[model samples]
Target: MNRRLFTAAGLALFATASLAAPALADSLDQIKASKTIRIAVDLGSPPFGMNDASMQPTGSDVESAKLLAADLGYKLDLVQVTSPNRVPFLLTGKTDLVMASFSISEERKKVIDFSEPYGVIQIIIAAPKSVTIKDLNDIVGKRVATTRGSTNDKEVTTQAPQADMVRYDDDATLITALISGQVNILASSPQTMAAINARRPQDPLEVKVVVKTNPYAIGIRKGDDALRAVVDEWVKTNLRNGKLNAIYTKYNGVGLPAEMLK
Candidate 1:
């Protein structure tokens, strides 16, 4: 090819590449300039993020976001997100950060940055007192219920492959199946089991075994280090001041876990 033609082609390619690249904006600066910060939360997840009787979002994650916005002197704009959509929402700039009980994991870290963990969750196997389930072996041959496509479902399927798995559309349905005697065991989170216990105080479910301990943190888009640093500092300060614990207690009826405080 002629030198002139080669040069023109190179310039065209460079322009196309630049146009395809996402415009990187300083998240903190944008929030400050706009006087607002958008946060994604799963309003369907209770104690962590859920709507109150008045249909207003009010939960541990929601309250934490509110505190963060207050500290930054910006208005909080909440966007409802589900487990599958949380990361996409943040990446697409629909939200500045995600505080919807997002559990930090190596796989997710590759796509997004996480602030220091501010909360912890225990995935457990819960069953009625009548059912004696000491471990995964005991779960064998038992009818286990879990939310379809959830972390609990994946764990149960892996750990107790011998067990009869009954998947429900959602957590509420899975819990119901267990409580109503349709299923003998349930794989669920501690907070979710606590809700079930509250509803059926007389029945009294017990935890058979803990499957995993997950640390929850705020999720930011990758390369947004400035915003991530600010969030991390804010979380550290709140953890030390007990403000984070207070927010957790307000929703879960208990203070933050001692391990999480560290």
Candidate 2:
């Protein structure tokens, strides 16, 4: 009655327990043999998995992916995808793993397995100086911009029902609205916020983080423990050797929390 044996026998009853462990390793080994690791990502979310000005992948998550691929003796192949498509890419075998600042969700876990967290996420609010909004309540009856289908959009809508939630199609549009003073506030992922803010040195529009923190991780398909275990252990060694912290501090505030490292 081994779980692996049950899954191999095609019994769907214990699908979760049986299939999860073996799928991960099979994917990783296939990549190793091919000498190429296909990683799904968001090239638009700066400082996390975005492409640099050179169009090469550069950011906390991307850099971590490079190391992870190298550790597995494979070259990393980056595939640009939106927030909406990351999970699908992995589950379809079109992507070996997703490192696009993919957030861990309970519902997602039912469909996709996730490695231990490799990064952190925080919701930040940006507004023109004219608005003296210090918190979520200050934006009542005002327009706020966030990427459509983003968790931040849901958070803002839940918190300020009186506020008009303007859901933009992408993070770029949300940033444009905030900078042009088209919206009272821009609520977006902190990773994108930091990269955009870093470029606007003289701009008066300021960003303030105003929400709970969350962790990020690579998303593997639900039955893939082999690849998941490799990614999880790779992150640990990088953080222990200070390479991981160096990458995050290069862009974001600092490395993952000490507890997260553990």
Best by TM-score: 1
Candidate 2: segments with Cα more than 4 A from true spot: 1-25, 127-135, 141-149, 164-170, 182-184, 195-200, 203-209, 252-258
Candidate 2 has its poorest 10 consecutive residues by lDDT at 1-10
**Candidate 2 at 67: error in angstroms?**
1.0
Query: What is candidate 2's lDDT per residue for 53-119, written digit by digit as tens?
Result: 7877787777777878777788888887877656555655678888887777666666677887777
* Candidate 1 residue pairs in clash (backbone atoms < 3 Å): none
Full-model lDDT for every candidate: 0.80, 0.71
Candidate number achieving the greatest lDDT relative to the actual structure: 1
Candidate 1 versus truth, CA RMSD in Å, comes to 8.2
What TM-score fits each model? Answer: 0.82, 0.71
TM-score of 1: 0.82
RMSD, every candidate, angstroms? 8.2, 6.5
Residue 222 lDDT in candidate 2: 59
lDDT of 2 at 67: 79
Q: Cα lDDT of model 2 overall?
A: 0.71
